[model samples]
Target: MTGSTLVGALVVGLAVGAVGRLVLPGRKAVPVWLTLALGVAAALLGAIVVGLVDRRPGGSPLLPLVVQTGFAAVAVVLAVVAAGRQTSPDPAARRKEEV
Candidate 1:
């Protein structure tokens, strides 16, 4: 992609990532960078899916935005879950430390 296109994608990605994090019920443990990366990926993937599913020359612009946001929300959830798993302390280790 061109430099302008890349910059535009990053802007959209940041917005999508913020929206995605907001969509979740609770606070997420994911970092901002990860969220941004996932958002970009989601946006690209959503575009591809929309392209394949809706081939009409003139389609509602909102569809792709909604799809990308949905993908971003899912990506945020997955990232939070993965981060939690990695950061959770071992129960046994915790007990030993408490001793």
Candidate 2:
């Protein structure tokens, strides 16, 4: 990827990640670093998908963005779910033990 593309990926990733964090309800226990990482991954995935379909020399600038955003949405949701699974404690598993 070009330097500009790399920067774009980072920017997109950060935005996607922030959105993911916001979309999740309840307590947001996710760390900023993790969100950033998820964003980067989502951006990468989106870029790959777009690259696969966007093989033309030139075309509308909006379609790729839409694809990327769509991918970002899916990725962000999945990331949130996965993060939630890992971060959320099992309510049933925690028995009330008296000391």
Candidate 3:
């Protein structure tokens, strides 16, 4: 990918990732960096998917943007799930539960 494409992906990723996080209920143990990375990857994947599906010689820009955002949302959900699995329990909570 070209530098511009990467930069665009990053920008879109940041926005899409933030929206994804906002849509989910409850706290996520995922770090900001991880979320950002997920967003970036998702955005690129979304772009690729849209590019493949769109056969028009000159397609509308809106469709690709929407598709990319959707992909980012899916990635965020996965990231959140993974983060939930990896989060360490608080010692106090564990002790309380044991008691």
Name the best candidate (by TM-score): 3
On a 0 to 1 TM-score scale, where does candidate 3 land against the true structure?
0.73
TM-score of predicted structure 2 = 0.71
What is the per-residue lDDT of model 2 for residues 1-50, given as tens digits with 9 covering 90 to 100?
Answer: 45655566777788877877877786655676787687777777777777
lDDT ranking of the models: 3, 1, 2
Error of 1 at 7 (Å): 7.0
Q: Please, what are the lDDT tens digits per residue for candidate 1 over residues 15-93?
A: 8787767776666678778888898887667666776898777778777667766776677678877775563278988
Candidate 1 C-alpha error for residue 76, in Å: 1.2
- Candidate 1 TM-score to native: 0.67
Q: Which pairs of residues collide in candidate 3?
A: none
TM-score of each candidate structure, all chains considered together: 0.67, 0.71, 0.73
Name the better of 1 and 2 by TM-score. Answer: 2
